[model samples]
Target: MSNEDFLENEDNLFVQKRVPHDDLHELVKYGDHPIYQGLKDDQSKAWIKKSLFEKLDYQTKLNCVKEEAMVIALERYLIPMISENQETSYNLALIRICTTLTKGWFRQFAIDNYPQLINLDKDLLSIARNVIEKFPIKRKKPVLLTHDPETRVIFDSIRPYTEILSFFDKLEYDPDDFDITGIKITSPVNGNISVTAIITTLCKYNFSCNPSASWSASVIILPSKEMEIFLRNYKSSKYELISDLTTKYIFSLRIKANTSGTSWGVGEDIWKPIYVEAKSADDVASILEIPGLTGDLLFKYVLDFLNPTLARNGETPLKHWVNELKSEGAIPIKPEQHLWYHAWNYELKSLFM
Candidate 1:
């Protein structure tokens, strides 16, 4: 085939093909991150330029170009060249790059910076569209912020379903009336049935909150599907499991600023099957209470819950309390864990804050 014919035929061929390059996939899949940033650096950029212009077979050329470097070339150089010369016949090297690195910033930077390429180059455009169609941009979820610290405080209690619903209803009625700085719930994953139901009810209750409330609240709505999966399939060490569960994979609920009405864990890491035995909504009302349950303390709780034998072997509640207090700089010197039981059992005046 003539070079021109090869270019045209190659475009058609690659547009329909799904070439898998592992490094390229990672770079494009996580385009927003710094993983591809090095490609734009001076040394990498030189390498990318050399690889792109080199005269080589298609597969050999692709192998020569680092995935991240290819992405950088397309975003910073190649696409811009194509944008300026839309009708020019790009070589097989350029065509393969476009089709191979089809997602994330590679697709986005092209679409945004050189929109004309869509109309000007059908083969490249089709490949880009395919990637976008396959991996569409996700919409950010609406965050629901509860001003009352009580939402988090009550999370520990075994409240009934109706009572929990009532609490939410009250918040929906006048979220602004409350002290406006407590819990922040950020929904990370989409299509969570539980999250969807909760958000739907929250949106339903036309509650109002202060127009000017700014408090850095705690509480992240971590991705729990994996946690559920882990709980159902817990075949690992307690520490390893807890580490996976508690490490940075957590997300929270966050309320957006200046919105009239905005709407909005425990299994993969510390798979506590006891949580599964809860028979009804009422029984599981407290399942979502996962604020401030981080660090060594959280791991301790999960270990004890999953293995009660360990708890029994450990010191009693009083002993734990005394030991904690004896340790200097232990705020709430009395330690709140003991207070929770005593206050509830003895019906004594206590503070949750």
Candidate 2:
């Protein structure tokens, strides 16, 4: 197909929008950042050229987070406190800075600053909270943020593809049967630890191949010999498995990779699961772009790839598409984006596209 044909094809309509970082940052007082003066910088430059519905840069969604010196940044957000119900409350000016209320050492700042924390821009809160969890702080009290009650949200926890590769390295299994039972989740450290679950992963090709391709996970029983390191890393370690799983895979919850870098982990407190769900929701459904990946669009995207057409240049369309992504430096941003890289083939896995 010609350039015009490619652009006109419903499958290839990449919606480019005006970059609003300049205004957005200004709105949130991000423009006055001492280190950077202008609204347009290397960061916004990247986003500027990026279309709203552009193909994934393949960076972990965390890469999209606005990173800052944790302590310094935390100091700025203010939370209000109620000292009294009457004139005393108005006179006291009961507002707390995040730093003073948070502990001196590594500890959670959000909880103490919760009333203020809830006010964070929804997307920023997800990336920011997950990043905070990565610090070596005591996370004994993680409070979950609330979601809008209007719509239902789905979630999936993804380990980086490296984790999948490390676990599946030891054994082989039938693609047709793909048994979760026989898949031994033995760790080098915990030779025969019991596992909670062996979940077959779902990788979406359309968004990102790096983490999406890193498929499958076997949760190691905690406090066991295993450190849950993936103990090894890589999806190429599982690419062969992926090539097959791609064809048979089905629906998977939208993935949320904890920035903590833990592959095999023990559960946190009772509220842990809910806190995770909140973060996971932040990662996936946080952003929706029209002319973007809806069920219909994704379906069409898969159909286009499945029914590839020959081109005058002697290339299959899908291969060309993958090549184009590569050409644009859409290489996997390693060091693990989410927890896993997942993959799927079109026959049964088309929905993943």
Candidate 3:
């Protein structure tokens, strides 16, 4: 199928529900029938058992739960069972019931708020990568680890860590001492335990914020298994190591005010709090390295970057801007816009070397 066709089908399968009034009422009435009466009557184990069986039978007779209310009831009753049983029928039923009741709420939410959803997905991916790097697994090429098909979704979500490890491992020079080593460690100490350490270091160095920025950097350290173990245990307060190899080539980035002269407001001195002038399309294009940054995207990046500063300075009536860069369409959006607000404030010399 064409991409549009596939998306349309997927949307139909997952979008939110809009039911007819009379049909919805009938479904509610059916759910309230005596046979299914006990489903909502009690909260204990015996009540749950009775409710599950009754709802199942009621749903079976109707060929499905018709009302949104019934769908919710079925979800609460059945999701636990499917999660535990791993039965194909049960899983399918749960998916159907959820999709039916939600009217594809999850899918619609994903579609309507694609940008926000993408950001959240990235955060989840980042967390997953951190978890994998912090907890090393010794699966060699000679032995491929296999998981149950049912758990494939969980596995795929975390597979980025493997790529992250490979990327870090390829960085031969350490950022700390400039020593050449094939291995890249994420922590200053050792092992795969430095998640907390790296985060702590980032914070100690003044780079912690709610939605902190991140970029890649490298550091060299002594090569020893004990050191590895120590680095493994290192945990930073806010910054996290994306990989668990050598401390080189760590991803780090941050957001800061556009403290440049142009952002200042009228009558606002350079020292006074003021809005930074928006970056030209050329400037933003250079920084982002995306040829198609439209005027709007450049405005977004600048505004987003300066959001915290604006809030702090009590800037009012915030305006978002967009500019077109010659003819390259819209500038490519930054994947990690959330992290742009919390920046490291120390001088380059103080933090490195």
TM-score per model over all chains: 0.18, 0.19, 0.18
Q: Model 3 residue 177 lDDT?
A: 17
Candidate 1: tens digits of C-alpha lDDT, residues 1-353: 11121122121110121222232334343234333333333422212223333344443333323333343333323333443331232333334334443343343433343333322322333333454466443453432222235434433331122111222233323332221111112222222322101211001112122111221111112224533566468677643543344332221111212212110000011111110000112212223443443322222222222221111111122233334444644333332432222212221121222
C-alpha lDDT of residue 144 in model 1: 28
> Per-residue lDDT for 49-106 in model 2, tens only?
2232123232211112221222112312211111212223211211221232213221
- Model 3 residue runs over 4 Å out of place are 1-26, 30-69, 76-328, 332-353
Better of 1 and 2 by lDDT: 1
What shift in Å separates residue 314 of candidate 3 from its native position after superposition?
30
Winner on TM-score (2 vs 3):
2
TM-score of 1: 0.18
Q: lDDT by residue for model 3 over 1-353, one digit each (tens)?
A: 11121122111111121321223224335334433334444421112233354346433423323232233322322222222222333334334434332233322432343332111111222322343355443332331223344334433432232211233344333332121222222322223421111110111111111111111222222223554565568675212333443233122222122211111110111122222211123332233233344333433332232232211211111111111211243322332232221122111212443
Task: Give the per-residue Cα lDDT of candidate 1 at 157.
Answer: 32
Identify the runs in model 2 with alpha carbons over 4 angstroms from their true place.
1-23, 30-107, 119-353
**Over all chains combined, what TM-score does candidate 2 have?**
0.19
